[model samples]
Target: MNTAHKYMESTQMPSIVAKSLPKTWMTWAVFFFFCASVFGLAMRYFFIGDFPVLEYKNLLHAHSHIALLGWGYLLVTGILVFTFIQNPIRLNIYRKIFLLTVIANLGMMVTFPVQGYGLFSIAFSTFHLLLSYAFTYHFFKDLKNIKSNTGKTLIMLSLVWMVVSTIGLWAIAPIGSILGRLHPLYYLSVQWFLHFQLNGWFVYALLGLLLSFMEKKGYSVQISTPILIALHLSLFLTFALSVAWSNPSNYLLATNAIGVILQAFAYWIILKSAIKYLNHQTNLSKNWINHLLWIGLISLLAKAAIQAALIIPDVANIAFTIRNYVIGFIHLVMLGAITFGLGALALNQNWLVKNLISKIGWITLAFAFVSSEIILLTQGTLLWAKMGFIPQYHLLIFLASALFPLGLIFLLIAQWQASFQKHQLPKFIHKQKNQFKSKNTETMKSTVLMSLGAAMLLMVSCGGGSSENQGSYTPPSAQKEKVADPKGIGEIKNVDLGDGIDEALAQKGKAILDMKCTACYQYDGKRVVGPGFEGVTNRRRAEWIMNMITNVDVMLDEDPVAQKLFEECLTRMPNQNISLDESRQILEYFRKNDFERTGGSDAAMN
Candidate 1:
C-alpha cells in the first residue's frame, strides 16, 4: 500500500503554470467588448436618425465606457490577480472584489440606456468609482510586498497614476456642466485630465505590466533605465505644465515640445534594446513577437511625427494624414503593440503552448484583421481628404476579415485535438498537453463551438460581400501638372479626381477632410459624437466655416451658431487647428458635392 501511494505521488510538475487558462476567459471578454464597441462606433457613424428607446449617442457612450472599463481594465486586473495572488485568502478577496465591481459596472452598463445619463447613471457611476477605489486599494495592498525592480517600479508608478486618473472620473460630470458656461479654464482642465489618464496612467501602467512579464520570461534586454526614468519625468512634467497653464504661452509650448522629443528618443532607445534582445534569443520561435516589436517602434515614430506636425502652420492642409496619425496611432499602439504582446504572453503559457499551431493561427488572424481594419479605415479617410479617390482594397479588407474566423476555427480544432489526443503523445508533450485537456470533453466542446459560432456571426454582420460590389471611385484620366515639392523631396503632380466629384479637388479635399474631419465626421454628414457635414456649405460662409473648423471650441463658447450646433449635437467638435487653404478645399468639396447632387456645373457652384 505504501509503494502504490508513492507511485501515485510521483508526478512531474509543469515548467510554467498554465496562466493561459484564465486568459481564455479574459480574451473572450475582450473580444465581446471590442465587438460591442465597434458596433457602437459604427452606429455613431452610420445611424444619425432619432430613436425612442435609446439615442445613438448615449448608447455609444455606454458602449465606450463598458468596453474600456469592463473589457480592457477588467481583463488586465484579472490577469494581475491570477498571476500575483497565490494565497487562497488573497485569491478569494480578489474574486469577491472583482465580482462585485463587475456587477456594479454591469449595472451601470445596462442602466445607462434606460436612464439616459440621468440620476441612475450618476448614482451608478458614483458607486462604480467607489468600487474602483476599493479595487485600487486592495490591489496595491497585495502588491506592497513585491520586491523592487525596474518593472515593478514602473507598474507601481502606473498604479499611482491610475488612482489619480480615477479621481478625474469623479469630476467628469460636474466639469462637463461647468464647461458649457464658458469658464475660461474649463477646457484646459478637462484636457489635462484626459491627457493624464490616457497618456500618464493607462499607457504607462499597461506597458509596465507588459514589461514585467517580458522580464520574467527571460526576454528582456539591457537598456538605460535612467534614461527611461528621465523621459517619464519629462512627460509628466510637461503634461502637468501644459494643463496647469491655461494659456498656451511660449514657455509652455517649448517645454511640451521638448518633452515630446524626449519621449520619442526614449521610445527609440527601448525599441533598439528590444530588437537586440530578440535577435540574440534564437530559441523563441514565435514570429508574432517580431510583428509586435515593429508595431511598437512605428507607434513611437507616429507619436513623434504628430508632435512635430502640430507645430506646422500648414498642417491642416494635410489634415487627412495628420488625422490618421492621431486616431489610427492609438489603435496601432493599443491593439498592435500592447494587445499583441499580451496575446504572445498568453500563448506562451503552458496550457496554450501545448496547442501551439491553433494558438498562433488565432492570434495571427486577430492581429491581421484588426490591423487591416485600422489601416483601411485610415487610408480611406486620407484618400477622401487628400485626393478624393478611394482605392479598391475591398478584396483585401474582406479577406482580412475572414482570416479572423478561420483562425478561430483552427484554434478550436487544435484545442479539441489536444483534449482527445493527449495520451498518444510523448511523455513530456503528453504531460504538457494533459494540463489543458478538458476534464469533461462535452463541456469544452460546447464552449469551443459557441466561440466558433460567435466568430461566424461577426463575419456575417460585417458583410462578406466584396468591395467591388459596394462600388469603387476610380480617377478619370486627365492632364497632370508637375510642381516642385515645397519640402524639396521631389516634384509633385496633379492627379485625377474620381467619379464622385471634381476628382482632383475631391482628392485634395479628402486629404484635408481626413486630417481635419475624419476623427469627428463620417463621409455622410452624420455625427461621430459630433456634428456631420452633409450640408455644411449651405449653412456657413467660407470664412466662418474656416474659423469654426480651425477654432471650434472658442466659437462654441462665443458664437451663437457654434453654440446652437453644440446644443443640438450634445458634443463639442474639437479644433483640428487647420489652416485657411485646407479649409477652402473642404468647402470646395462640399460645394462640388452639392453641384453634383443638383446637376449644376462646378463654375456655377463657385
Candidate 2:
C-alpha cells in the first residue's frame, strides 16, 4: 500500500494475469480516445469548418458517444478499478465487466456514425448501462471495506450521482414523448444527465482517487468534518446552475446558487490537500503534465463562474437559447476539465512511457486540446455577438483535432518500444555481460523515423488549406432565412375515420417508419435519435404531424413547436418528402398503435 512503489510501477506489468490485463485494457482504452478524436475531427471538418467526410449529425452522435462512453468511461473505470480493487481475485469479474463496456462502446462507435441512434446503437448502449449497474453494485460492496470514511464517502457519493444521472438519461425518451421533444424537459433531461455525469460522478471519483492516493502516501486531505458534509451535499445540489436553462422556480434557483458557492469551497478544500502533497514532490519537468492539470483546474473554475453568471435572469435567458454557447461549454468541461485531470493522473502514476518522443507527443496533444478550445470558445463568443463566421474555422479545427490522434500514435509507439526494450534487456545483458547495455540503435532509429513521419503529416494537415472544396461555416445569414411551408401541401385540415384501423394502409406506414424513422424515433415509447412515438396522436394534431413530415425545414423555421424541438434536440429532421396519401397513412398507423396500447377496440375520433 506504499503508493510511491505501488503506483510507480503500475504501468509496468507486475503479475501474470492481474497487472498485464489492466495494462492491455488501458492501452486499448487510450487508443479508443485517439480514434474518438478522429470522429470528433470529422465532425468539425464537415459540420463546422471543412469537407463532408460524413453526415454532420451522424458524426456528432458518434463523436460524443465515443468520447464519453468509449474514452472517458473506459479511462476512468480502468484507473479506478486498478487503483482500488484490493482483492486481486476480484480482478476477473472487473475485467469481464470492463470488456463488456468496451464491446458496448465499440458497438456505439460503429453504429452511431452509420445510423446515429438506432436499434444497434441503443442495444449496445443499454448493454453498457446494465453492465455499469452491475459494476457499480459490486464496486460499492467491495470498496465499503475501506477504513477511511472520507475516501469511502466520496466514492459512494460518486456512484450515487452516476445512478442518479441515468434517471435523466432514461427520462429523455418518456419525457420527450410526453412533450413532443419540444418542451423544456427534453433538453433539461439531457443537461441533467450530463451535469451529473461530468460534475457529479467524474469529478468526485477522481477526487476519491486523489484521496486514496494520499492515504497510501501517508498523507490526509485535511478539511473540517462539517465542510466535508457540505462538499458532498453541494456536489448534488449544484446541478441547479447547470440546468438554469430550464428556468426552475426561484427557490430552486437560490438553493442551486448556494450549492455552487459551497462547491467552490469544496474544491478549495480538495486543492488544499493537493498542494500539501505536491509541494513535497520533486518530479517537475518540461514534459508538463502538471500544466494540463492547471488547465483543468482553471477550466473548472471558469465553468463554475459561468454557472454562477447564469443565476442572473438576463444571462440565463440568453444562454438558454444559444446553441454555440452550450456546445462550447460542454467541450470545455469534457476536454479541458475531465480529460486533463485524467491525463495528469495517468502521468503522475507513471502510467505513460517517459521518453523524449513520448514527452513531445503528450505536449503536442496538450497543444491541440488547448488550441481547439480556443477556437471553439472564440467561435461561440462570436456567435453570441452575431458575427458571421471565422475564416477557415472548420479546416483549422479539423487540423487542430488531428493532432490528438497523431499524439496518441507517438505515445503508443513509445509504449510499444518500451515493452520491446524490457523484453530485450535480459538478452542485451546476456550478450554483453562483460560490457554495459545501452539504447537499442534499431529501436531508436524507428522512433526517430516515426517522429519525423508524424511531424510531416501534422504540418500538411494543419497548414493553410483550400476552403472552397472543403467548405465554410454554417453561415450566420442562414439562421435568418425562415423555412416557409409550401401552401396547402400535405395539409390535413380535417379527419375522416370510418373504421377503427386502416389495416393495409397502417402496415405500409409501419414499413415506411421502419425504413425512414428508425434512426431517430421509435413506435413504442423508447427514444432512438429522436423522441419516441408513444402517444404521438395525443401530443400533436393530425395537421401538425402531417406538416412536420412533409415540410420539416419549413416547420423548423417558422413553427414555434418545431423550432423548440430543434433547439432542444440540437439536430434538425431531414425532409423525407412524404406524399399527401403517405402522410394520411402514417397518421392512421399512429391511431392503430394508440388503440393497441390502450387495449381498446379500434375507436374512431369525430
Candidate 3:
C-alpha cells in the first residue's frame, strides 16, 4: 500500500481528518516557540543577575509559566493536533472541539503576560487547560472504537498523562500561592509544577508521538522500542518517586539514590537504543529525527552524570555547579531535541527537504549548544571555587549567547522564504468555496487581534515599572552625612583594617555586612538597598559601624537611627552576627574607599 493508504489503515481517522492535523500542529509549535523564547530570556536574566533586582520570587514565577504553560502545554497541543488528525474521527463535533481548544489556548496565552497571576490570566489559562483536557478525553473515547495496537498505546498514554498533569495543575496553583507567602518552600512548589508538567505530561506525550511516528514510517527495531520505553518509564518513575518523597533522611536519601541509579540505567538504555535505530535507518528523511533523538539521549546522560556527581561525597563541594549543568541539559532537551524534532516535522509537512537556510540554521544552533554547554560548565565550576573569572570567560559566554538568536533569525528567514514558494491560501480555504468562508475569515482576524493584544501585554509587563515600590530614599540617621569628596571615585583599593586580623575574621565581617548592611549600604556608599558608603568612615567610627551591623536587631528595637529608618523604609535591617575579622574587612573596605577618593595608591591603603 502507498503512504496515504497506509496512514488511513493505521489511523481510524477519515482522509479529511488526516489532512487537517499538520496545519494545526504547526501552528501550535509556532506559538510554543514564541512563548518559550520569552521564558528562556526571563530565566537567563533572573539566574545571572544580582540579587533583589530580579529576586528569586519573580524568577520562580517566570520559570513556572515557561516550563508548564509555554513548553509543556504548547508542545502537547501540537502533538495532539497531529495525533488526532492521523486517527481521523469522522465526527464534526470532535473536530470543532479540538479547534475551539486551540482558540481558547491562544486566548490564554494572550492574557498570561499582561494579567500575570491576576484574575483574567488565571481564568483564561484555567479555561484553556480545561478545554484541552475535555478535548483529549473526547478524542480518546472515540479512539476506543479503533483497533490498532500502536495507536491504542500512544493515545492511552498521552490521554492518561494529560489528565494526570491537569490534576497536578489544580494542586499547583493553590500550593504555589500558599508556599509563596512563606517563601523558600515556594520554590519547591514551582519545582513540583515543573516536574509534573515537563516529565509527566510533556516528555511522556513526546515519546509516544515519536513511537507513533516511527511505527507509521514502517521502521521497526526488534529491541529498540521496548528498551526505549523501559528507559523512559524508569526515568519517569524515578522522578515521580524523588518528587513525592519530601524527606532527605537516611531512608529517603537511599530511595533518592536508587532513583538516580534508575535514571543512569535509563540513560544507558536510551543511548544503546538510539545507536541501534540509527544503524538500522535507511531513509535520509530520518536524519533530522536521528539527530534530535541522539541529542536528547546525550542530554539525558549528561543530566544523569551531573546528578551522580552531586550525590558523590568526594566531589560534593561541586554540587552548586551541578545546577548549571542541569540548565544546560534542559536547554539541550528543549532546543536540540524537542525543537529540532518539531522543526523536522514542520519541514516534512511542507515536503521541503534540505533547504540551505534550514541547514545553516541547524548548524549554527548546534554550535550554540556546544559552546553554551561548555561556558555554563566552566562558569559554574569556577563559581563553586568562590573565585571570580567573569572577565576571563566573557568571550565564550557572549559567543554562546549569540548563537540562539542568530539561529532563530536564520530559521525565520527560511520560513519566510518557504512561505513565498507556496500558495498563501490553505487547501481547506480553496476547497470550501461557500460554506462559512466569511465566518472563517472573521475567526482568523480575531485570532490575529487576540495575539497582538497578548503580545502587547507581555511587552508591557516585562518592561514595565518594577513590581516593588520605588520610593524616596530615607537616610538611616539624622547624622547620615553626605561627603562631597567621597572616596572610591576612580577605582577600588583594598585596605588592611589591622595586622592581627585573620582571613576568617575578615570573612565574618564581610558576611555580617552582606547580610545586614547590603540592603542599606554599599561599600562605596553608592545607593542600593540603602545609602552609599563613600564617606562612611568620616561619619561613623569603625566600632560604631561594627556595632550597627552586628546588632541591627537591637538597634531597630531601641536606636533612633534604626527606628527612624525602619519607619521610613517600612522594612527592618536584619542583624548579621559578625566576628572581629568580618568587622575589620568592612572597615578595611571603607578605608580603601576613603584612600581611593584621596588619590592614594593601593600600597597607601594597605
- Provide the global lDDT of candidate 2 against the true structure: 0.66
Give every collision pair in model 2: 49-394
Segments in model 3 whose C-alpha atoms lie over 4 Å from true places: 1-21, 38-68, 87-116, 145-155, 166-168, 172-180, 183-185, 219-251, 283-289, 308-322, 341-354, 385-387, 390-399, 416-442, 451-606
TM-score for each model: 0.67, 0.67, 0.64
**TM-score, structure 3 vs. true:** 0.64
TM-score of 1: 0.67
Clash tally for model 3: 14
Tens-place lDDT per residue, model 3, 30-83, is 445545454445445432334444433333344445545554555555555555
**lDDT for each residue of candidate 2 in 1-606, tens digit (9 for 90 to 100):** 698865634522223336345555666677778778888766555433334334556677788778887777877777777777756567867866876676677667666665555555666688888988998998888886767656667777888888898898799778655554545566678778888888888778777776776777878665678887877777767666555534435666676777867777777777667755765653445437777666666677777677667656546544544544666677777777777776677667765556677777878887887788788667656654545357876677778888988988887787666654533345533444212123333533564455445434433453312223222222122345645332223456665656568798887777566444543565666443466677777667667777777766556545756665564446546545467788778877887887787554223221
RMSD of 2: 15.4
Kindly indicate the candidate among 2 and 3 with the higher TM-score. Answer: 2
* RMSD of candidates 1 onward, in order: 12.2, 15.4, 9.9
Q: Write down the lDDT of every candidate, Cα atoms only.
A: 0.53, 0.66, 0.51
Compare the candidates by lDDT and give the number of the best one: 2
